[model samples]
Target: MFLIVEESGPWKVDAVKAGLTHSLADFRIVESRVSSVETEERIRLLVLGLLTKMSRVRPNNSASDGSSVDCEGHVGYEGEGEDVGRVGERRVNMGNKLSSKQKKKRKEKVASSLQIRNDFLTGRSLTTEREKCYDPRDRTLTFVNGDDDLDFLCEDFKSLRAKMSCGHAVTPMSLTNWCRRLLDQGECRFVCGQTDCHVEWPFEEVCKMALLTKEEMEYFEKTLFRNVAQDYLDVKVCPGCKSRVVRADLSELSVECTTCTAAKKRPYMFCWQCLREWRGPAPRSDRCENYGCINQPLETLRNCLHITFNDVRGVTGCPCIRACPTCGLLVEHNKTQCKNIICLRCKVEFCFVCLKLTEECLKSSTHFQACSTGVAPRQTSIPVWQRK
Candidate 1:
């Protein structure tokens, strides 16, 4: 028996020959139809109906050989068409269905066998001979618990760095980069990365690290020295700029406040002891011209006297060995006045005689008489049995 499908258009003819068996319900065309007015769906339905009719035909009632349907839809027999349809039917039946797992395994196998380009998702192969994976724990590569592992490059911050207090390490370059970024966003502080430590990043320490150049480091060091002198050594601040005056000799009674001196383009001198700005040519005088000023024994005066007196001059490297009874700062004395001395700092009128602090020294004579021989003999020197 022959099944001839009349093609409605070129698509139908091509569809029949190109294995539309799945869409056509396992029925392959026996002979293709070249002309018809029907749609593809209608043509498929018509072919299906013909295949159903062919199945119902009696065994001896087959159509004649090489006979087929024309455009008019007359049925004909083409000897080879029945054989092709039977083969398609057998193929449809014998094609086995695969489970999900089997399909996955087949896909994996095909992927493994194929040489795929590296798109990052699939990893790249190491092409170098020395590209073997190395263990940092290897003794030859790294020491146990060494800083090598902790070291990191921070090009943005621009320096190599050591581990911080909490054992976390980052380069100064990285810290600087992060600091600038955070500061731009109005952040005041940053915490250490070490969770347990939780220490705030110190602004001063970071500033020191960030100042890597020679000029910057020198400036920072000088600034630190000035701060130390002002904060610890009681150096006075400039009344003009509030910067600490550069006093190379702390014991010097006279100081020219450099900050104030630079302004107005003239000499502006001040007393280091009183912090009083000196006026006129008096700063150039042998003594501070300011009356009632306690800085009578100026360091310059003592140095001048040292030139006169060869004896007791070289006894002490510093002409001023006596510290302020109140502030303990060394003050130069020419020994011109009475032993009753008042500290410029703290302004306590303490007797220079035996360093005795007594208001009586300024008023009464008894304290001076008691302190006359310098320090009084130790009370411990007297026998306990003769205790007065």
Candidate 2:
């Protein structure tokens, strides 16, 4: 067998090189002299690490060698044939001086791989060759061991996406292509953590609801969530039309333009059912499309088709979103409760007079008899009226 080794201390170098020739493949025993202080020294360390791993995979022969441990352990020779002085010599033996440069480059590659592994195990975002998978929320791609240092995979979520559905609360960049995968294998319901009120609610937005900020988004990186009943109200947001939500005055609603209720010409409220626009003070409490106030004392609010309701307490300013007509506030939907109308804002039924929700009529009162077109009293029971 051919024994190859660096010219090191005469005794150590010859013995190990000789032992390897007898017990291991002749081509396997290879070594070289590298000064401990030079860049080449690090290369030697890497090679040593590789050698240790390789030895484990292909065990050394014990019968030909002194002992199994001895074969695996150090076999440093220490005589004149072994050249210890070679360790201090510059690695200029290669005919070309540029050889050192090539060796240094190889060492750098090894360092980079070790670093990538480290970052992945610590839950930090690292880019691979194609996409960025690290978002502040429940991103796709199940990171191995919570190690996120993938630097070669993932892509632009929007570009790669194929389609989407409601209540997923998917971000603008979320991939649509994965929609099929998510729906087919969705293990948990995605929840929105906008506030404590929506503590456990579905994250999907309806009618173009706004998303949370970056900082707020980070708060739920690993949290699993779900929604219940009409819990969406807790996550509601007032779309700041033209960024004019704060300074607009709500008092002179009569003189204001329908599209320009607030200072910045923001539509005060949007009819969820018809998508009609409303200006000034919003309904005190009612489902957006259900209306009893349409014929109530307040003529200003009569145009709204929303169903009104009182809170659970049956008082004015009702929190109920569906099946209530006594409230002035309108909810966008009607799903979780009975169709009976209850008024919480005025603490009274539609027959009782409380004007909190009655600020939007063209005339003084919304009574059908008061209209220019004579009233025909039809006993049609609106859904909200039954809930009352």
Task: Identify the leading candidate in terms of lDDT.
Answer: 1
- Candidate 2 Cα outliers beyond 4 Å, as residue runs: 1-121, 124-233, 237-268, 271-388
The residue ranges of model 1 lying beyond 4 angstroms of the native Cα positions read: 1-227, 230-234, 249-251, 279-292, 295-388
Residue by residue across 229-252, what tens digits does model 2's lDDT show?
011111111233322111122221
TM-score each candidate: 0.22, 0.18
TM-score of candidate 2 relative to the true fold: 0.18
Question: How much lDDT does each candidate structure score?
Answer: 0.38, 0.27
State in Å the error of residue 311, model 1: 40
Top of the candidates by TM-score: 1
Candidate 2 overall lDDT versus native: 0.27
> Could you tally the backbone clashes for each prediction?
5, 77
